[model samples]
Target: MALMITDECINCDVCEPECPNNAISQGAEIYEIDPNKCTECVGHYDEPQCQQVCPVDCIPLNPDRVESKDQLMDKFLKLTAQKS
Candidate 1:
């Protein structure tokens, strides 16, 4: 599943640079995660880097955008292909 930043986010600016997929962006209020680009760090890290670095613990899986591990890997592969 893609992760999302909650309103509890303090805008700490730590998670943005940590995203391998560059899925996190500053929104009107807080940082937002683009589901299309987020693979929960599957292709890059064993764990979600953003979640590890978020001090507020506000990043959580987007339940509404639930996806299996294989789906996440597919997205990751597609993203890497676009870069090449």
Candidate 2:
């Protein structure tokens, strides 16, 4: 599953740089995680970097946004398509 930032988010900006996929970004209301770009760090780390670095534990698994490992891998490939 991909992690999502809730309204509880302080806009602390703590989770932004921690995302390996660059999936987290400031949104109109709060920081938002792009499901298409999120990989939960599958290709880059042992865990989701944003959730790992979030001080408020605002990043949580999104059941509705769930994806299988293969799906996440596909998303990962799309995210790092250039992989330069």
Candidate 3:
């Protein structure tokens, strides 16, 4: 599943750089996660880096954007292919 930042986010800016997929960004109110770019760190790390670094525990899986580990891996591969 892709992770999302909620209103509880403190805007401390830690999570943005922690995301290996470059999925997190500062929104008008709080940081937002781009689901299309997010892989929940499947191909980059054992865990989601944004969730790991968020101080207020505001990052959580997006229930509406549910995806299997394999799906996340596919997304990661596709993203990398685009960059290459």
Candidate 4:
């Protein structure tokens, strides 16, 4: 599943730089995660880097964009290919 930044986000700006996919960005109110670009760091790290760095613990799995590990890996591969 993709991750989401809830209203609890402090906008401290830690999470934005941690996203390997560049999925996290400053929204009108809080940081937002683009489901299309989010892989939960499946191909890049053991855990989601943004969640790890966020002080408020606002990042959570997006229920609306749920996906299996294989699906996430597929998305990661597709994103990787696009970059190449």
* Backbone Cα, N, C clashes tallied per candidate: 0, 0, 0, 0
What is the lDDT ranking, best to worst? 1, 4, 3, 2
What would the per-residue lDDT of candidate 3 be over residues 19-71, giving only the tens digit for each residue?
A: 88889888999999999999999989998988888789999899999999999
Residue by residue across 1-84, what tens digits does model 4's lDDT show?
A: 999999999999999999999998999999999999999999999999999999999998999998999999999999999999
State the weakest 10-residue window (summed lDDT) of model 4.
60-69
Clashing pairs in 1: none
Q: In angstroms, give how far residue 19 of model 3 lies from its true place.
A: 0.9
Better of 2 and 3 by lDDT: 3
- Looking at model 2, residue 21 earns an lDDT score of 80
Instruction: Name the candidate, 1 or 4, with the larger TM-score value.
Output: 1
Better of 1 and 3 by TM-score: 1
Candidate closest to the true structure, highest TM-score: 1
lDDT of 2 by residue, 1-84 (tens): 787888889898888898888888899989999887888998888888888778888889988897998888888887788665
If scored against the real structure, what TM-score would every candidate get? 0.99, 0.89, 0.97, 0.98
Residue 75's lDDT within candidate 2 is 81
Off by over 4 Å in 2: none
| Candidates 1 and 3, the one with greater lDDT | 1
Candidate 1 least-lDDT 10 residues: 1-10
Candidate 4's C-alpha runs over 4 A off are none
Q: How many steric clashes does model 1 contain?
A: 0
